[model samples]
Target: MSLTHDATLRELPTEHGVLRYHEAGDPGAPPLLLLHGSGPGVTGWRNFGANLPLFAEHFRCLVLEFPGFGVSDPTDQHPMVAALPAVGRFLDALGLEQVDVIGNSMGGVVSTRFALAQPDRIRRMVTVGGMGRAIFSPSPGEGLNLLMEFTEAPSRERLIEWLNSMVFDRALVTEQMIEERWAQATEPSTLAAARRMYSRAALEGMAKAASTSPEPPYWAMLHQVRARTLITWGRDDRVSPLDMALVPMRTIPDAELHVLPNCGHWAMIEQKSAWEAAVLAFLTRKD
Candidate 1:
């Protein structure tokens, strides 16, 4: 069923399990994968809504729902690093050798891991507000849980407050967006999975994933990647701040950085035009 445009929801099998994804634009065109952030109601649809169709205009775009989010699955069992191989598996399943990857937040972290682990599988990389260092970023699962509680029990005021903490502009937190997010949060298994993700063990796993796998002093594997990369940051992002992730952008041999003003964590959403243009230019650049 076509919702807001003709983006079709589809599913594909991976080594671990099934993955639900959205595909739009032309299938025969160059492939570009869109990865969503880690937030309540944070499907690829929500994160890339403004940019996906536009990307599809010139290239094939696939937006994937990570296992624990959206209609994919209901468990926090897969850490960001563990999911790296799954991206390869996904490419295999789709018969794709390599493709440009555009990811945000957690997906960006996973994308980095995938590119590092299997460089040949990635044609290029673009990360928006990506995590490249371990910092005291608040747990999105915890935030999602609080939103869930407020939703199931009817706490509109509380939900609004929680949203304010996410976006730099409180005015952008529309009542419609809040209600949609509330619906997703209040779903039975979604909250449980989010709770599981918020546990101490999971938090530690996330830290380890961030430090050892994606970015950091343990960036030994990153030097192997040959794909040209683009790092875009919302200057005002509290989660995965630009300053913390600068090392990856600077250190990676084939990387460039762009810091967007008047934007927050969700740069692709908040600065759609600039974000899309930067990404397209990066992907199509002749080097």
Candidate 2:
């Protein structure tokens, strides 16, 4: 079946809320969950809409909309915090025992955490940026600053700034893209959630809390992941710099790294063919 927006859209009621997702390909095919980033106005459809048809040809593509994002029900918890459980519940509702996952930015972080917490559930994992902490570059890089700035004050100019930071080529940030992002991003609840996640005050509080917390950061636990991971990054990623892939590359037992040149945070979008070729080979490889 052709993977169109309306044809693939689906929803499931879970205890947390009604979880929305886009599904394509044969139900009997191996499940491939595509988790989206935490950027303002981000949604599963927006993130993977272009690649869904391609991926659906090989595997059942499930593009899940994490809660606290405008596409799904709002939750009191931060979107990042809420995503892990939402993933588990979504899979449970679908009766999926194991699935391959492709995560972008914030989704990558959540996927790593999920793999650590429930090692057997994920078959193979692929992450596009936003996995590990910065080893060399400053934390919360330029793209993040722009993201926070826009979250703190929703303006078209700020949104465009943040969008520009997402890609190495600014031409990708078209008028329609900006308009769609602006409409969803400025929605009262969505904007409030963005503030909770990316506002200056929220960021500062998180840093302070983490500094005092005894719990080790997620990157430290990468060794425990049973899934073979493919960590993909854009050479010019401004949000989570290319250097952030270091820890995971060195740590995850059976991990491979793929760096796409002339790309930024949105590697999958900015370098679509290269990203897809590498990821498809990894996911389909018998070895």
Candidate 3:
């Protein structure tokens, strides 16, 4: 399969486990990594196929499925904590010394965690509805249990309902999209991972606050980040909430915020054209 084709899956070995990722864009272009959200059915291609080529114009986009998520097995490290090493190993394997990263939702949290830990590894970051785990910010769903309820007993209607809740424009939640997500969610491997993740989260006390903020100095560290950051969000987002966007706006000195109207959590999908333009412009900015 072609780079643009996700049906042809590829795998790369990391210290923890093998990551199933999709490759796209100009092989010679600067490496740009795209991380998918933490939704139960998310996969690199599912999350990014629409916009991969847009970025591919200027980047060698490596869309990766986080360990324990798409086609990857659960690792010893809490799935959340493995983002750093996963990306590290990915880069190492590809001979990419450093690269720019763009993450949404949980992917954003992981990107934030990775950037704080190894600032030098990241050139720039774009977090859309980024659910950074910094404890200072608001918790997930503003303390709602809706996502869990949906996941516990998922169906085409429930998936559609979840998307309707997630995207500001109900019309954007199409039947095909709903069915596709439902199919991905019900896949035995993916479903198993979700169950395991739910269990692990409960054990780690993350079942409720998957978006819990990181530890001390993390706030300070966010302030210290030298890489230019772009924070984007749907103004009406309930999944991660719009208020948390303020944390990065105020904390990251070099960051800028762009909130889209009539949009919800999935800005990249709901507001793809605008989101892509904003992301490309920010990542390409030299100043």
Candidate 4:
């Protein structure tokens, strides 16, 4: 289910675990790495398939699967902490001196931490429907149970429900999108991973705790993000509300905000053209 298309998938060893990734565009082009969110059956392709070619036209694009998700080998280490070193290893393996990073949701969380720790490694960062900035305050929009929705009784209907919850306009959710996600969700191994995501004891504080506790303490040091940043959000997003974007807009010295109306958490999918254009303009700007 992961390689349903013609995209080339590759694997490499990282400090955290084996990493699987896909790359496209010219070798000489500036590199841009796309990181995905945490959701059942989420992979780089699922999150940014509609985006790769458009972005590749300007810059080399590399999309890496999270250490434990997609085809990448699962690790007992907390997936969150594991992600930091894993990304470092990925860059080392590729000999990329610096890259522009675009992250969504959980991956956006990772990018923020990565930028703070290794500011020189990232030229610019874009976060869409991101989390981890909620340390200041948690705004649970629409009050949906994201983790339980998948774990209770994983089904096409459930995935659709979760998908609909992310969007202001439910009709944008295409049937093909539903079927593809359903296929990945029904896959025996992916479903098992989905179960672990919500219930795994080792992943507490990383996933489970982050999901359950409204007051889950977070360290959103927005002041530390030195790279030019673009924060995008669907005004109707429930997982990470539009209010969450305001924190970065107000704090990050070089950050800009773009709120898409009638959009959902999956901007690249729901609002593909506008999302791509906004990102390209931000990454290419001289000043």
Candidate number of the best lDDT: 2
Query: Pairs clashing in candidate 1?
Result: none
| Span of ten consecutive residues with least summed lDDT in model 2 | 1-10
lDDT of 4 by residue, 1-287 (tens): 13233555777876556889887777799999999877666788888877877787888888888766646877665566667777888998999989999998888888988888888999999999865455434533342365555655777777887877767778877898788777766676556666565543434435556677676333447777889998888776776767677667887889888878778788777788888889899999998
Across 1-287, the per-residue lDDT of candidate 2 in tens digits comes to 55778888898998888999999988889999999998878998988999987898899899999998898899888778889999999999999999999999999999999999989999999999999989999988999999989998789999999999999999999999999999999998888888889999999999998889999888888989899999999999988999999999998999999999999999889999999999999999999
Question: Which clashing pairs does model 2 show?
Answer: none
For model 1, residues 28-74, the per-residue Cα lDDT tens digits are 99999887776556677888766766787888888877776646755
Q: Report the alpha-carbon TM-score of model 4 versus the true structure.
A: 0.85
Q: Against the hidden reference, what TM-scores do the models get?
A: 0.83, 0.99, 0.86, 0.85
CA RMSD (A), model 4? 4.1
Candidate 4 error regions (>4 Å):
1-4, 14-17, 132-144, 186-189, 192-196, 199-219
Model 3 residue 66 distance off true place after TM-score fit, in angstroms: 0.9
How do the residues 1-287 of candidate 3 rate in per-residue lDDT, one tens digit apiece?
35455453678866677788877767798999889886656777777888876887899888888876646666655566676688778888989888999998878877888888788988898988855443444554531345555556766665666677777878876767777777778886666666554433453575335346555634456787767889999988877777777667888878999989888888888899999999999998777
Segments in model 2 whose C-alpha atoms lie over 4 Å from true places = none
Q: What Cα-based lDDT does every candidate model obtain?
A: 0.71, 0.92, 0.75, 0.75
| Regions more than 4 Å wrong, model 1 | 1-7, 13-16, 79-82, 134-159, 204-220
* Residue-pair clashes per candidate: 0, 0, 6, 0
Q: Highest TM-score among the candidates is held by which one?
A: 2
